[model samples]
Target: MKKDDQTVTEATALHSFDAMLTTYERWAQPCSQTFSRAALDGAALPVGATILDVCAGMGALAVPAAELGHRGWAIDVSPGMIERAAERLKPHAGWSTEVMDALDLHFGDNEFDAAFSVLGVVYFGPETGTALEQMVRVVRPGGVISVVNWAEPLGATFFIPVSRAVDRFDDPEVGKFVAPLTEFLEGPQLERALSGAGCVDVRSESVSGHFAVPSAEIFMEELDSVFQVLPQYRAAIAKDRDRFRDILVEEVLLMASKELPPARANIAYGRVPTPQETVGSSGLATS
Candidate 1:
């Protein structure tokens, strides 16, 4: 990605998350818990190990890692998110948070014992691999790296309202604030991203779960809060705020009325290769 595009992406994310600081966690409790659980489970983090949580929104995984006795370092683009994460992790001495870009992690190579991102890098449009490589760079050889991304069909279903609303209301020339979820949906595509990032022993699994959403009205409110910062979304809202809200609410209710089961997410895990293993496999020696 160009430097300018990176800046825009970061700014866009920061704006959206800044808006969500107070209410996001409460609204996302269900999906957040599920994603964090899956990422942590795949992590299998040893107690006291140094772990990095990239795109660590509100410290969902970081707080738990700290509770589990891991020395946790969490990063996100949004200052608001970092601030809230710091508050959540304040009780734990081993936890810390930073506002940084995931695609350009500043830590030295092999700095972490394990690293993970819960639904983080997959939204980087075409720069997902660049972010993943940076993540892999920070992990110690043999340390685990895990990521969670949405599954296609279920993800599409979940976001159908937003998609339809955007198509109908937003200008076609405007760019998407968030990339299509399907960009990172397939399991093999995720595996390839890990392998391409130089991670070894890559594996992926599906995690299916549901949120006991209270009502369509509430669900629509929370979901809308997440992406209102998107230029196009904001533009559409400005154009016809009430109609946009009404349309989205109606569409969300249609899905909620069906009471569909929880959709599945694909979780991937991989290990950074040890020096000896790297040498044996490719005749390459470590520094």
Candidate 2:
């Protein structure tokens, strides 16, 4: 990403979630609480393990991990978010939160016993390729790596049209910001990425959960305000703001007419191969 693009991304994030910190937890309550435990369980770290929570927002998993007897180190790009997380997690001695980009983690090699990013990695898109590599590099050989992404089959249906609309109207330089939205649509693709990143026994499973919003209009409102959609669609919003919102409203209202569950997602799990194991003649390691 270019410096300008990075700047825009950072600003957009700070404006979106950081600015809305008062409402983020309430808005995200359903999904975060529903899926966070599964993510921690998937890591299956023993007692006292040191864990990294990438893109950690509001210390959702970070605080809980500390309570579970692990050292939880959390990082995010938003200073406001870091501040809020630090405040919320201050009472817990086993946790700490920092402001940093996930793609350029500054920690030394094998610095963590395990690492996980829940729903957060998806925002980084293919950039997550580098983020995952960073996780692999920092975690000790054989440490577990896990991520939870919005699965296409169930989760994307509600949001795809909105993302597509943004990409269609946004500047060409941005080049399909929604493309990363489908990065983990297929479990096999995610598994392959993990394998390519030198993770062994890679596994991705569709995890089902539900979001209960009062109405379709409220859903659209929160989707635009609470989530990071505003940043991706910033250009379009500037170009014709109300029209963009109208388009999303129309689409979401149509989906809501179905009267089904509001949301669902998938979780992918893998482990960095231990140093004693050889991956292939390619000079990597495998479990």
Candidate 3:
């Protein structure tokens, strides 16, 4: 992506996240906490290890790592998110949050024992590889780099209603809205990205969990906040916002009434290669 495009993407993401921050913090806590634990477990960090949480929204991963006795440095593109994370992490010593871009981390080489991003980074779109490379660069050799992304099918579930609403419009431009919301990396695809970023012994697995919501009405209310931020969603409904929302609300309520399957995620992880290991693998000898 060009620098201009990347800047626009970041700005748009920050805007969406500003609107999403409250609902996400409330409705997404259970799922975020669960996935954070899974990512940390995959990293297998020693206690007191220095860890980095890239695109660490609201400190979901950082808080758990801090509780595990690891020192954590969390970074996100949104100042609002960093502020919220700082508040949550204040009680823990050696835990901090910074407003920073994932594609260009400010940390030094091998500054951390491990690094992770949970339900984050994949949204970087075309810049996902660059962000992962930054994560790999900041971790010490032999340190783990882990990330959790929503499996495509599971990721699409929440947006099914939106898709249905768009279909009612029968317009190509409106249909484009579904693509961005549902296009997520599967396990193998994610592994390729990680391996390409210099991680070795890369592996991924599906993790199943669910978001805890009390009722369909409340769920729709929280979710509507999310849709409002999507520029495509706004544009699609511009001609008939109320009609679109009505259809979407009805679809969501109906879907929620049924017994939905647990949300599944792909958690990929690998170790950074040590100098000796790298040389040995390359069949090179040191002087």
Go through the candidates in order and give each one's C-alpha lDDT: 0.75, 0.70, 0.76
Could you tell me how far off, in angstroms, the CA of residue 94 lies in candidate 1 after the best superposition? 0.7
Query: Which wins on lDDT, candidate 2 or candidate 3?
Result: 3
| Per-model tally of clashing residue pairs | 0, 0, 0
User: Which is the leading candidate under TM-score?
Assistant: 3
**Largest lDDT belongs to which candidate?**
3
Task: Give the deviation of candidate 3 from the true structure as CA RMSD.
Answer: 3.5
* Residue 65, candidate 3: C-alpha displacement in angstroms: 0.8
TM-score of 1: 0.82
Between candidates 1 and 3, the one scoring higher on lDDT is 3
Candidate 1 stretches with Cα past 4 Å from truth are: 1-8, 153-158, 164-179, 214-223, 229-236, 279-287
Deviation in Å, model 3, residue 37 alpha carbon: 0.9
